[model samples]
Target: MKRRWIPGCFAALLAFAATAALAASDDPSYGIIAKHKANSAVRISDEGHRIVYGSPKTPVAVEAFYPLRAGGEGHEWVFEYGYNLVTAFPDKVRFVAYDIATPRGGEVWQERGLTCGAFLINGKREVTVNGKKLSFLRSTTMSGWTFAQLKAAVAAEIARPRPARAAAPKKPARPAKQTVIHVTVPCGLAGPYGEIVHLFRARHPEIRVTTAANGIVAMLNQLRDNKMTSDVFIALGLRELDDPAAQKRLVSGSITPIATIPLALVVPKANPAGIHNLEDLTSPKARTVLTYTPNLSGGYGARQALQEAGLWDRINSKIVTPKVPDQCKQMLKTGKGQAAIIYSTCLKESYLPDKPPVIEKDLKVAQMIPQNLYSPVVIGGAVVKTSKHPAAAKTFIDFLRSEAAMKVWLDWGFTRLPGA
Candidate 1:
């Protein structure tokens, strides 16, 4: 009876062992190993019941596989894994396992478990698991962590209590004050400068810019006499800086080019004289208005354009010289002249019919003076040495060269200088 009982018990034990082994083999983790084993791209082999897999195309150089047998339930499978050096994106290491189960009942190796960590080759401690928020371990040898050690590190981080955050300190009250940056721009630049100032003030509400439109020469003289307090001087030409008085007032090596102003032939809305181009200004019947202040860029540019077209003498004969380019626009609108040679920026401003007698009509820019004959007016600025707000002044000057400011200049009919 004893011998018969022993035989039956031994047979039962053998059957139970076979059933457990079959269950382990049927697990999703084992399915992933089997799938990779058949994949030509992944070189897989088994060592002591452990599935080892690697691929040159994969970021993971090599990884050892194991299943979290205790917690695995149906499609929900977890993996305890480890990897050696990652060839591609070595800083970030990810381990992924697959399963074959879906509500749609499709047979495919779907992603089952994934864990990622970062490491540095230079032996610094910056390893994070899953994301940067959950930093589990920091060591030089994180890449070499064993499966047991990696699992333990993750468990420790999850179980550890977070430290209580300290209360934030009260912020000090800010003083109610604004710094003013006095800037002198040419009369021809009033429109563009107004837009630029508006944008600058919007960005920096702490600084206030007081702008004055005057001849560049007059602005320089005021700087010399200390009559007008200015932080910056924006001139239409670099020649303005050549003045000994301006050179003395401005900081050395602070002059920088901003943009180039092209000359445009502006005509009245009706175009009563039928002047459409530079050649049209040569007509004896054409009453062409010319800017006279040669020191001002628009005045200089107008003369240059007419001289290049070989109509300076012919056109100059019918000239009604305005004090400035703004006056030139005024003369054309008031019917004092049919056409005027002025800065393209000035012509753009004339479109606004805000001022009465300035009708809402299409004042056309007939033609842009050829750049070959007369170069575009190159505008530049310098920080005055005597500025009360020197830092704010320099900040404003830098803003003038910004892409946003350059776009405003372009929209106003000026071209940005190369490297400006």
Candidate 2:
């Protein structure tokens, strides 16, 4: 599915190789491979043809399609930006791409940035992943160096000793040990990081709170192993907090609910599939999109809503379960899914400041599922007992319940917990 395929910058890059170069129904026929060599962009198509481009912003040719193997999801037609090139990966050409992220699935989500090469996929996306992606049914979900990071690194690998250039002035070392506390949450809940951290910093300037959103499973594994990428774990589900607390991975009684998120029935722009409500998914015309199985973090609420509606058995087979929520959105944005079940906060996550989220042009909330359909998802967290910064962790965790932080959370579409 879409790897938060909201293409804008390099930050959101991540996903896997699709079958063949692309799906049969897609256009452009072949994706033009791009490379940086000798200060020029070399664009090469599948037919062994090549084009030398001088400008960094030249339009790279591309073909867009979905692999039938990716749960039979549809192709995303990239806009004029033509990020559709990402659909045709596995070209075996390694380049210093993305900012570099790794691993997938943990008590927190640790996902490989992406197996394919899509452009800056965060703001004003070039293209989105709107299909069901190949889930890691295999043992290894994500591992190893999937992409290059620097041209110098690649040159070093080739044993090419070039003339040395003068080194630039060294920058200052990390400022005298700020009490940096890393907080990991699902991407949808990441929107408030700036505001919350800002307010916290206003009073606790010595403490630095860094927040990132990913699958909770990926982060937890790191916590369990004491890797401690996170000092504070704010998750989309309470199970994440409870399970670790049960194992004594966290400080005693530190686990607590931070907020609750309601569910939404999301549809693509213009309601192309004619899905006006949840029940419409059962019809031949609708593709009820879902997050991958083990739905703890991805399609957790969608599965619940359908089951609560007594439509699970009837609509289960027709669902396309992507590996993540972004993938589900991608399927819809690229013209695949009829409806996606997701947290209402997800709308806030993808909302553009220029327009309201409910009126999002690419995807719209078709229905706001009643709370009676399912229990509100409890997003909670705890201070890691094994943390390198325990005091700072507790400080930030405590700040989450503060009046200031609660305002940011609510602004980001979360409901404040009782007595928070």
Candidate 3:
């Protein structure tokens, strides 16, 4: 009977060893080993000796791979392949190199951005804690990093000591207070400033803000028609602010300017039509020009420029009107005309492939003639007088003017107003 029991124990020991091996196998090999920088929230991967950041734009050379032990549910080595080089450690040993791999083999979806973190089979990313993985994970949101860096960060975390746990404190009798705010913002400038809004939301999760990108006139009409929506109104023209009807509809002391935008001339690159100055727009050679329909801001700017140039008739003949700024941009991109008179901001936002052909080069920002005719496009925010959440709207507006909040808007090429 004792001999039989010995055999049973031997079998049990073998089974335990196999299970351990399988768990260990879940960890990666020859992949991201570690990250060096803390403030640099970039993800990384390994390509043999080279470490690559997730973004294709910024690749740096990696010096070494320091592997770490994987515990609990284990980590998956998902290689978003790209020819990007990244450094493992910045201070001790900063190795900056480039990734030379071709685009054919790399993951495409993450070309825009990438990060590596605890993930579950249900398609939710989680946060790794102790030996166990926890749920309710916050998504890793970031910019300015390539794919290779993401992989290296995972490896580095494994090698480093786990973050020290803090002692659980006694529960407070009162719950932490949070402020909720609501705001209405313009849709046109919304996309460029999304990061700013997101940052503000992170701080004041209670704030329920909304945005609409419709033209200014349309927004005012909505308010007047009483089909109004949103806690705040953001638009371009100042006339709305001074209007008796609009003033009556707006909450007192809520109207304020947030940013100042300058007018600019948008033309195709090289200006083949010899349209160097505003006067050139009237020359006989100038056959076609891009502008928004008479109703839009771009069209108004074009009209003003022609008037200043003293050749409204010459420029008018070449008017190629479009309904929207993006539409006019598209027309210019396709070489539909030589140039389009548009806002400088629109020109800055237009996307053209890197190193485009000469014909595409014609699309660009042009200098204005004498006096420059700088049109001050003011973007303002106001609380709707009829909004049910008037207090919330005020809180949201305050968040937009916060020091932490202004940085986001500044990044989008907006100059904050004196009070904003």
Per-model TM values vs. the true structure? 0.51, 0.57, 0.49
Q: Any runs in candidate 2 off by more than 4 Å, and if so which?
A: 1-178, 211-213, 224-226, 242-248, 292-294, 350-359, 418-420
Question: For residues 102-219, could you state the per-residue lDDT of candidate 2 as single tens digits?
Answer: 2112211112222122222111112212232211110111111112222122222234343665696785564476876766555455446445665787888788665544444445
* lDDT string, candidate 3, 1-420, tens digits: 999999999999999998976755554432234322233455554543235444443222222111112110111122222112223433222232211111111111012111112112112222344464433111122112234334444444435564565696784442255443334333345444445656766676666333333344445656676545456777654444666777778888888766665555667666677777677776776678877665444466567767766778666778878643446666665567776766555533311112111122336677642324534456667888778777777766676667776775565555567444
Candidate 2 achieves a global lDDT of 0.50
**Candidate number with greatest lDDT:** 1
Pick by TM-score: 1 or 2, better one: 2
The Cα local distance difference test for each model comes to 0.56, 0.50, 0.48
Clashes of each: 0, 38, 44
Q: Sorted by TM-score, highest first, which candidate order results? A: 2, 1, 3
For residues 1-420, write the lDDT of model 1, one tens digit per residue: 989999999999999999987876765656655554454344454432233345334322222211122112321122223332221223333333321111111111101111111221112223345554222221112222443444434443434464775696675543378887777666456556666776897898888776544444446556666554577888887766776766888889889888898877888777888888889987765855656467666677778878887878776777777643345665676677888777666544421112211122446777777877675678898888888888899899989979889997887778979554
Model 3 scores a TM of 0.49
